[model samples]
Target: MRETPVLVRPGDADALAAGRHGDPFAVLGPHPVADGAVVRCFQPQAASVELLDGDQAVAMTRVHPDGLFAVRLAAEPARYRLRVTGRDGAVVESEDPYRFPPLLGSLDVHLLVEGTHHRLYQVLGAHPRAFDGVTGVGFAVWAPNAERVSVVGDFNGWDGRRHPMRLRHEAGVWELFIPGLDHGTIYKYEILARGGVMLPLKADPCGVWAERPPKTASLVWGQPPRPWDDGEWMRGRQRRADRHAPVSIYEVHLGSWRRRPDEGNRPLSYLELADELGDYVSEMGFTHVELLPVHEHPFGGSWGYQPVGLFAPTSRYGNPDEFRAFVERLHQRGIGVIIDWVAAHFPSDPHGLHWFDGTHLYEHQDPRLGVHRDWNTLIYNFGRTEVLNYLVANALYWLEEFHVDGLRVDAVASMLYLDYSREPGDWLPNRFGGNENLEAIDFLRQMNQLVYQEHPGAMTVAEESTAWPMVSRPVHLGGLGFGYKWNMGWMHDTLDYFSKDPIHRRYHHNQLTFAQLYAYHENFVLPLSHDEVVHGKGSLLGRMPGDEWQRFANLRAYYGFMWTQPGKKLLFMGGEFGQSSEWNVDASLDWHLTQYPVHQGVQRLVADLNRIYRTEPALHQFDTDQRGFAWIDCNDRDNSVLTWIRRAIDPHDFVVVAGNFTPIAREGYRVGVPEPGFYREILNTDSEWYGGSNVHNNGGVEAEDVAWHGHAWSILLRLPPLAVSVFKRDG
Candidate 1:
């Protein structure tokens, strides 16, 4: 049948031809006319066009030489499809994207503007949905400053002239639904900024999967409801994340942990890591594995720190589903997964959130408030409502969708202080004339509150170095609301003392004992993290102050000291087996070191320390409370020896820990005990199993009535050389 057509406005016709129309919905698609509706279609490559409403096909008249086709329909609207014959003689038919209504609901708009939409990712990304009984992908973006936005990819010749999105002005968002488009389709937003200026094609901010770096395009992906296999881990995660629980985290950088040397030295896929990493960590007796950021990033050298796609797992390992399976596999093996989350700042990658929508949409406009000088990155404007919603929703996405047990927030100190890494005059103070970042504090509090409220068992740790008051305290008590804080002071002080020669160690005794002055100020994790071993800082083993055997002994004693410390513990990858060299991101760890007995001994010592830390209530139960720790003899500077007692909630359950720092064996060393009983010798770092001198007490020691170091009982025994010993009272 032949169809009649009406003329379009001259300005609208010109703007549509150039793909710079501000309000394309008003001119294109189905519009109301005098007595009927006019359907205008733009197909620059079409030889001819036909409108199909089921059984009837009406020929559309070409109204313009630039390929504008239109037809007049009945007064009442009817669903229709456009059949186009390309100049190349190929023909195809599909639903017109402009005919579909706006996909975002009013509630979404209200919540998004209010910054309370914790689930913003669900509404604003490319989603494959059934619209009007037709399968297509719904694309939405928050680019209020753009004159026109279109979905461009191979499907439309990557042209901005096709599939212009309809702008929902209330929330400053644009959305469209194109039929027959689904997962695995590569696409990006072609935006025409105001004043007819074209910007670079921007990737989707809410993409769940993306093409690998150097191929910077957002891939259309959807997440269906997954039948998770970690129900048992999910059900009891709360109890496992208690303040007193034994949380020995094994920190790892996935790319360099252990690459397959034969496969062009590429990193293991997520499926391989799921089983291999899970087995290694489980056998090592660690309670959890804290992965470096798994977020999709352009540069692997950043080790996932400078991420571009917050929601998408890095395709360098595997797809998102395989990453999910990795978490499930770890959970199945009784080990929890904690991902390093970076919300403080982001890299200034052009295709990323930088200058999105031709404005400072995600980051601050001012350099003092936005730029990270140290990292050459951009800081998020935490004061912005939508930015807060986006980041908070991302935190929940990892916990909810991927089933991760916790999030160890990266560079929290940088977020807390406005003057961090800045000169005196280069920073802006808060309204109260302080350097604290008030907006970032608010965002952190809200994120933590929502995380704990939503996922009871999941923890949020902060890598905060400063003495921020109550960082791990509850939000209601005026705290920053973190589950744990890294004990950076202890790590630095102890490493400094260990690096010193034992002959000069007496002068640095305060370094080892000064941590207890503020130990209970926060829930602490004694982290020997990746930061310690990278960038020319040699391995932990190389930092010791003695010959090879004495270095091994010092390391053993140090692990024993750390495990029995008054906090949870963390060790970076390769630290367990004593990798000889500093960490290199371009290559696998020195895995061959484990074949030697000295390195194997260190690994065995770490495993036993984990076992004792978990099995003994006194070691972990009072980890955050002062009531659980007491100084037995902290003033023994002359001998370079220190002794302490750890108590559980029950006074009867206690263990005494003693360390001899020097190479001299201190036989008949009298150590104070809380009770009169036979103390069972549990662990001696000098045992032959750990490649140490076999200088240890036989069986156990019985306490005497002799008062010593303000204790009611005392025990005299052989103290090993450059080693630590743990003794539990057995009555």
Candidate 2:
């Protein structure tokens, strides 16, 4: 350990002025001194240094003429305060900043052995020395400002009087070498100031164990090994044939997915959720299950955004091993699991890790750049090296440690700008004064690079609303490198069109067509996220126009269009069953709504849609290839009808989709097709299973020939208003 004496220059008036307030050493030197060590403090501004014992002051001869005070305590356990008077007789106490009541010094230490040769010290109430028969204890703390530190916890019985901690000089750390006392001991720190003010240290930011007030330290226990058997199950399924194939997703909040009021409304456990939801997802036909944030969070209602412990799975949802088992179960059932990860901001809980070391340790201290006004949370200084590591490590932790297949990064738009949700003067501009937060951009790039390099098959999706160019592009090409992005445009446009009157829809028909024009430019996923079903906007089923029957018809037509559209899809919880009420995070999903015909019909339609998508080669095929899709007829504005054909590169495989936006059925309408062979009706939105008027064309109806180019054919068929139909050409 390197130890140097404090320096005082005669001409440095500022350094001297700083010293008069206390032991100039407190301001300029390390604290929590050890016995048999010579320590010195120099105040260039101090007129004199007088040593005091319990308010009785006595002048001490200066060891150096240059305002340097040196003293060597005769034994261990000594407490001394300094009296430094300024040139004007101004006196300051060593405990000026630390006015709180001094804690009793009874230090206790618990030695925990994490692994062979890996020992940890967990300090409990003040005591002294290592007790017999104890094996090990783990020790950690959050202190960014202390010059010297040491562990003095319950193992020592709060006694700094005996067994004082020695500072680990090189690491800016303080440690107590305990020989015995083992795990499950409470602890606190004995931090020596450069001056005389001594304080207790705080908890570790990355602590696995946490406890509430009155119960100081959490009991750290070893995690039991979990047995999972999904590796072989995942490798057996065929890879997705097409990217655009009716990729429907069921978004869920596990805690609220199922609960009964009679059962005290307790949330389902991880094992129960997997058992119940796995079957439900398979039956619903959704290709993936996108879950709300599942990481350990301090507040339940904040929706898991304000994470305190990034590594630990929320103890609220079973144990760490149980969560692993739950994820493995999902994989075994052939459903991909997507978890929400929030690296944007964190809660400012004192015990949680905001400023554990009494400095802006984990976050930026400058309020202009560090504070998130809208959330009242602490924003990470993404520019810092350690901060970047923390976030990147967290992402890897979820994917490798918990076996999560994908990550849907929440609030990415907020992470992209310096003025995100803030006004002028309320936020600080970067070096360029531009709105772009370059630090955030650099951090995002690094995070994406690390994730892709470490886990190639793992998917990273961004919830970015802004038109940030190349967000889904690979990092080598200057893109953010997300696998996919939530298609906010589609959600907004569809919601806007659905809420409008039929007469008004004529003007807004372009909103539905506009998404297709540039949809393939960036890999996109159409999402009806939780935002659409919360805060009075109502559920997706409730957003339809017209009367009760017409409303259900509108919903059915919308789903048909959504499935046929050239992109992946995600539906928030309660949407597949046509939930009538808005989502309530506090309660279970509206499972009771399944009894209603409209709701059941919606569910049946979704299930059939998934089945058709799996059977058809045209839907998901060409998900990124431009040549796989074409609009057969988009100019039928007067009839409120749109026709599109999805084809595979092989030319023999294809599916034709037609949508009629009007509210009245049109008989014997002739629509164009891509191939001239017999076109058979595959899926109709107006089927009785979907709560339609039973006007669907019978399956396997052959289409007659017509004069058209490029193997195109025209078919005259009965087209229902506000419905969609898919046809496959029989070879």
Q: Which residue runs of candidate 2 sit more than 4 Å off their true CA positions?
A: 1-137, 147-204, 209-221, 233-247, 708-711
Residue 610, candidate 1: alpha-carbon lDDT: 96
Q: Model 2: per-residue lDDT, tens digit, 237-308?
A: 224212434446788888898986898998888888888988899887877788888766667777777877
Query: Counting only residues 3 or more apart in sequence or on different chains, how many pairs clash (N, Cα, C under 3 Å) in candidate 2?
Result: 67
lDDT of 1 by residue, 1-731 (tens): 22332557667777888888877778778888777888888898999999998788888878767888887877635688999999999999988887877899999999988889888889998999988799999999999888899989999999888888989898889998889998888999988887787888988989999897778788987657669999998998888889878889999999899999998999898999998899999999999999999998988889999999999998888889999999999999999999999999999888898988888889999899899999999999999888999999999999998999999999999999999999998899999999999999999999999999999999999999998899999999999999999999999999898888899999999999999999999999999999998888899999987899989998888899999999989999999998889999999999998999999999999999999999999999999999999999898898899999999988899999999999999989998887899998899999899999889889789999999989889999899998999999885
Against the reference, the lDDT scores of all candidates come to 0.91, 0.67
For candidate 2, what is the lDDT? 0.67
Error of 1 at 185 (Å): 1.1
lDDT at 19 for candidate 2? 23
Q: TM-score of every model?
A: 0.98, 0.77
TM-score of 2: 0.77
